[model samples]
Target: MKQHIYPLRTKKLKGSIILPYFQGINGDRMVVPFIFWALFPLVLLTGCGGNDQKPEAQQGPPPKVKVAYPLRREVSEWDEFTGRIEAVDSVEVRARVSGYLEKINFVAGQKVKKGDLLFLIDPKPFQAQLNLTQAELERTQTKRELAKNDLARAEGLLKAKAISGEEYDSRNKGYREAVAAVRAAEASVYAARLNLQYCEILAPIDGRVGRELITQGNLVNGGGEATLLTTIVSTDPLYVYVDADERSILRYKRQHGPSLEGVEAQLEVADEEGFPHHGRIDYIAPSADPETGTVKLRGVFANADELLSPGFFARMRIRASEPYNALLLPDRALATDQAQRFVWVLNQEDKAEYRRITPGAHVGNLRVIKEGLTGQDRVVIEGLQKIRPGVKVSPEQITVGGEQ
Candidate 1:
């Protein structure tokens, strides 16, 4: 029997070399033509010179990144806490005397000083009562004078033994009662005058007044529960209340002496960048809260611009350590390596090297580097991920807080 040879298929290789052969059983193996070997070198050259092929990109100078020398400055470390801005003096304006709301003396949301008139209640009723009390007091005084004259006459009669002692004693009792009545009437007159004065509601403290709750022409009840007319909150000087841990409280007290008052504190609102508002702690709690193990502290800040309002979310910082010269880097330059904090620094060869850092309290965007860096180290501030243990980098130098 003849050993049959069959070409399975043909493939066009390179430019024009068509080859057809594939492995088969020993008995069916077929020999390839020598023409394939002769043209293989030419095919290789044609494929290499094809127009569709692209050249490899030349390795550009290592990735460009922003770098900065550690900022060296005299700095004070601070402990940060969050709290709310509050008014030092907050008052719920209420009517003290019950009457018709006759007039509103000041516009809503206006700043009012102590004793500034804010509202007015009808004074007609109070004036009438004052008049009645005055009249009653005059009548009582007249009665006391008449009683005195009667008692004097009775005394003479009693001495002469012209009448019983009972009548003389009765006259004496009447004089004393008249005097008591006058005193009661006078008290009533004084109260009536006070009620009339209350007709003009005045601000008890300097503050910004809120909108009136009960407008003019409304009857305000000042009896059992006074009517809430509006609210007022002191604006110039404000308070920020924060709860500090026992450890922090102790640390602050130890550093600034036992008395924490007058120790400088700084505050910033949620939208602010740094602690721009400056103040001092005015009050410290004598006892710690049993549940939280924290003490409440009150910071007093002058809000002359009235930009800081009560109930605003704020961050408060109190000095924790004295000022000292320290090395600092922008917070963006710091990164974590498993359990340790580290930053990439470019060496003399412009290659990044891992530098482990022991960080201290954060001072705004910059963090205090307690360890692992010198003033000469150029830290990688931007393009952190592109940096490797020893990767070369093209660096652009910038200040710690300068824009990247």
Candidate 2:
């Protein structure tokens, strides 16, 4: 029997020793593959350090949007319109009987009562004509007296048979002709009197007078060409003309019937500070203005205080339809793409969701919500550009001022 043992050999000359036994086992041939396999897991683990470097998840809600609760309010429904103020009765005072203007009796821009003296024409020529007519009437009266005396004498002689019937008849005819001449002369005197009175021009209406067209000593003719002396505009009652769209008027008519008598309107002048006066709808045009598709509506206002004047620019608030409660949104909350309007609404879990809205009339800076939104929903007004769909949001309650 023989005992066999593997011997471990070590040779160290300077610093290290190489064992030739591993070479005998083909160890060097396995060096490159073994190094790769040893470092492979470390490289993969270092490059794929995913959990440690994961990005921080976005916190809580995306943003806080301002919101409000829409409540029903009793507002007097009104429609605004641009209009013009006019006088109920306006007339141009023109010179009818012409002569040298003797005096301008009324001041310009003064309120005058009816029959107030406005202007005076020279009456010297008219006075002379009146005196001539009077003299002619007197002469004709004297002739008629003499003719009547002769007719009486003829009638007495014919009854005594000293004069023929033909003579009495001739005297009667003479007296009749003389009497007719006197009547004609009297009529001439009346005509002369009227001509003299016509020299004075009077205000035909109670109104305010405009600028004077003729000054003193301006030669004017009786029955001359129509010359503008001044303009008179009645101020007790004023008229306003307003235009309304045809569709709106028709809708109102369909709901409220044809008449607008009881409808009250508030009127204000353009430069005035407040609505100084109110009026009622007096007229609505039977047809619409073809070009504008609007109907002309007129209102009458009592202007006894003389606050309103003719040709003034006016603004009117008219009751065009019935009042109803509606959802309202701030104009800034609205977003538009192409022609479609939209807004971002908050969900129950505080997420941004887009809502398409149907917009109605504009109530001042606010817009009337017609459809596509419930009054309870929260609408995003500020920070809208920073939000998108499915983003979480936090709603901050806000108080809306004014109409919106």
Candidate 3:
């Protein structure tokens, strides 16, 4: 017995199917597969265009960072240190001759000049000694004149051969003895004058006086080791001694050589709260202190108004070098690790690239960047905590000025 075969066909229109079953009688089995195949593609297309489908992922702008243009400046830079103020010149008033102070010449704590009388001792005794010396000197001169007349007469007698040669020699010796007596009396007069001058005490230098060590009627002696009558200190010009660390000294040497004159210093009274009058570097240590590993430097300032007092604590700032054109950034912009000091730079590709930087001196609150970043680079000042290498970023502009 021969079996019958079924044929299937699909129509593009309406996506329906026509089939022949049992050679002439119609059977739906062949059309069933064709109809389902055409309808399946339509169902898939409707699902693709349906509201139930998800939309595409949305993208926002890249993260932003602030940027500042660096400026080149030529400034007088300085290194600062806490220092102590001292008098440029000072002296202690002392009694040269021992005596009872009968009178005080000036008030205590007053400014005095050279040769000014400071105190007076009892002058009555000195005056009496002077008078006695003068009277004795006159009496010695009268005897010397009389002895010379006797010597002349004795010489004439020797020439006339009227007296013995021995008698004439005796008279010549006596005349010489009288002249020696006159010389002794003149030395006594000099001594008396010196004693009279010692009765008054005078200032040795111009300075402000300190508290009086001895008051009027107080007996002071030269034998006393601590014979301090009073102390005087000069206040017109003052000294400021400052200390600098070894590192700072080395850095300054690299900039200004080993000489300190090329470096200028300014002084600010430590008690005062502001910029101070500028000064010059007066001296620097030849060697470093072993214990503290620092160098001692001193500066001199004109304290004309007495604004800077002796023994006052002050601040000394030394301008060690000239200013440089550099990129200045906030200290927070720098990230440090054991590896190196670096900062995040937002590249044109909107990526945060880590850049290594070599830092320089700190000018005010900003830090100088010696290497690794250009003036045009966008520095990650904010949002640095959130940034990482190769991360996309956006940059926002920031305003920054050079060190004043």
- Top lDDT prediction, candidate number: 1
Q: Rate the local accuracy (lDDT) of all candidates.
A: 0.91, 0.80, 0.79
TM-score of each: 0.82, 0.71, 0.68
Q: Could you give me the TM-score of model 3 versus the true structure? A: 0.68
Worst 10 residues of 1 by lDDT: 22-31
Model 2 lDDT-worst window of ten = 21-30
Give per-model CA RMSD: 5.9, 12.5, 15.7
Estimate, for each residue in 133-242, the C-alpha lDDT of model 3 and write its tens digit: 99999999999999999999998999999999999989999999999999999999998888789788888888888887888998766545536788888887778898
Clashes of each: 0, 5, 5
Runs in model 3 deviating more than 4 A are 1-67, 146-184, 223-226, 243-263, 272-275, 283-296, 330-333, 349-352, 380-396, 402-404
Which lDDT tens digits does candidate 1 get at residues 1-404? 97845646566789998777654555454557779768989999888987876688988779999998999999998888999999989999888899999999888899999999999999999999999999999999999999999999999999999989999999999999999999999999999999999999999999999998987999998967999999999998999999999999999888877769899999999788778999999999999999999999999999999999999989999998889999998887899989999999999999999999999888877899999999999999999989888889999988887764
Q: Assess the local accuracy of residue 101 in candidate 1 as a C-alpha lDDT between 0 and 100.
A: 98
What's the CA error at residue 402 for candidate 3, in Å? 8.2
Predicted structure 1: clash tally:
0
